[model samples]
Target: MQHLDDATRTELEAAAFRRLLHHLDEHKEVQNIDLMILADFCRNCLSKWLVAAADERGADLDYDAAREYVYGMPYAEWKAKYQQDATPEQTAAFEARQAEKREQKDA
Candidate 1:
C-alpha cells in the first residue's frame, strides 16, 4: 500500500470531496431518496456530517448553512428546481432494501 503523509492525505481527501460535490451538482436528476435507498446517505447526510465535523473542531456551524454549502444553493430552492416526488415503486423498493440491510446486520 502507498503511504501518504498526513497533510498530503488530507489534501487528497479534500480534493475528492470537492469532486464528489461537483459530480452531485451536475447530476441533479439523481433524487435524494434514490441516494438514501442506494447508499444509505444523501445530501442531507453530507450536510449533517459537515456540521458534526465543525463541532468536533469547536467551530459553530448551522445545519441550514451546511446544507446550502452541500447543495450548492438553499435546499428549498434546489428542491423546487430539481426534486421530484417519489413513486410508489421507489418507496416500496427503498423499504425492502432497508429491511434487507437490517436483516443482514442482525445476522
Candidate 2:
C-alpha cells in the first residue's frame, strides 16, 4: 500500500506468503498439473521464485531447500506421499495451456 512504509509492506507480504504456503500444504489433493492449467504456477514455481528472491538478496538458498520450505517436507518424500500421476484429461489441458502460452509469447 502507498500508505504503508517499506518495512511494513514487506512484513505484510511475507506473512501473506507464509499463509499461502500453509494453505497449499492443507490442500495436498490439488495437483501441480491442475495448478499449472488454472493458475500458471504451482508449488514448484513458488520454490523457484524463492530461490530467485534469495539470490537477489545475496542469500544462499538452493532449489531443494526452497522446495522443502514450500512443501513442509523433502521433495521426494512429498512426492511419494501426495503427488499423483496426471490423468489423460489433465495432460491434455496442460498441453493446451502450454500452446496458449507459446502463442502469446510469439505474438
Candidate 3:
C-alpha cells in the first residue's frame, strides 16, 4: 500500500468532505427525519459536528455559520428551497425508532 504524506492525506479528506456536502445538496429530497431514523445523523448533525470541530481548533462558530458551511447556504434559505413538511406517519415512525434506539442503549 502507498503511504500518503500528511498534506496529501489532509487534502484527500477535505475533498471527500466537500463531495459529501455536494451530494447532500444535490439530494435535498432526503429529509432530515429519514436521515435521523436510518443513519442517526443528518444535515443538522453535520452542522453541529462542524461547530465542534471549530471549537476544538479554538475558533468559536455559531450555529448559523456552521449550518451555512454544512448546507451551502443559510439554513432558512435551504429549508425554504428544499425542506418539506414531514407527514404525520413519518414523524411517528421516527419517534418509534428513536425510542427503540434509546431502549437498546439502556439495556
Q: Mark the 10 consecutive residues where model 1 has the least summed lDDT.
A: 1-10
Model 3 misplacement above 4 A: none
Per-residue alpha-carbon lDDT of candidate 2 for residues 1-107, written as tens digits (9 for 90 to 100):
99999999999999999999999999999999999999999999999999999999999999999999999999999999999999999999999999999999999
Instruction: Pick the lDDT winner.
Output: 2
Which residue ranges in model 1 land beyond 4 Å of their true spot? none
How many steric clashes does model 1 contain? 0
Model 3: per-residue Cα lDDT over 7-106, one tens digit each: 8998998899999999988898999988987888999998899888888999989889989988899999999999999899889989999899999999
Model 2 bad stretches (over 4 Å)? none
Clashing pairs in 1: none
TM-score preference between candidates 2 and 3, better one? 2
lDDT tens digits, residue span 19-71, model 1: 99999999999999999888999999999999999999999999999999999
What is the clash count for each candidate, in the order shown? 0, 0, 0
